[model samples]
Target: MTLSLTAQDKNTLRTAAYGAVSLIAAADATGSPHKIATHGSIALASATGPVGHVLAEKSKIAGLDGKTVAELADHVLPALTAAMNLLREQDPAQAETFRSTVGIALDAGVGARKGEPGPALTEMRRKISTALDAA
Candidate 1:
């Protein structure tokens, strides 16, 4: 069976994803609220820009456009895996911090909303943490 997302749905997903990236970036930069940092905290701040750009660009690619949530998750998994791997190699502690901070954000942002039909952010965070831990 074919699955699709309306333009509004895609825009919503993009906004949420970008918002998460922005929150991370801001936290890494100022270290006030979340304080999520890497060994090279300055570098981490720089890295997030490209990561955010890539996520925005890739999500709108032909194959990913109109995909269901699960399908979109599958498509993005490799990028997420690669990112977690890179972070772990750079700073294991910071990688763990990344996962935790992301989890916290997702809990507040996505988890708080009732009746959302898709993969739980908690589950997604678990997968990311597991991957980082294994690495």
Candidate 2:
């Protein structure tokens, strides 16, 4: 099936994908936040398929400049769900691709830390996965 995403839909997907990496970076305030973000973003860039295409577009994604973690989550978590919902409705396969792409990006981002993730980082990862599954 052909998936027809509007500009807003594409923006939502971009926001959700990029916002997740930002969330991980934010959650690692005490650690190497820049490393985490770079690794996660690189993984996101490596994604394939429709999800990858949407992420690759360098258009105006929304709500990524939040000053606080909580403020960022307010826009991102819902965007994660919304992106998933839109994909699932139009193409379940793409939805799975989207979910997996985000999950892989999260893993790559979190793996930038050499040792076990701290409690806050662990919880933020869980929340990201939960939001992806919420759709």
What are the runs in model 1 whose C-alpha is more than 4 Å off? Answer: 1-66, 115-134
Model 1, 54-123: lDDT tens digits are: 2334444332332344554444444344445555655555445555544454444433234442434445
Q: What is the C-alpha lDDT profile of model 2 across 31-122, one tens digit per residue?
A: 98898889988998888777888888888776899999999999999999999999999999999998888888888988897788899998
Q: How accurate is candidate 2 locally (lDDT)?
A: 0.90
**All candidates: TM-score:** 0.41, 0.96
Task: Give the lDDT of residue 12 in candidate 1.
Answer: 38
TM-score of candidate 2 relative to the true fold? 0.96
Question: Which 10-residue window of candidate 2 scores lowest in summed lDDT?
Answer: 53-62
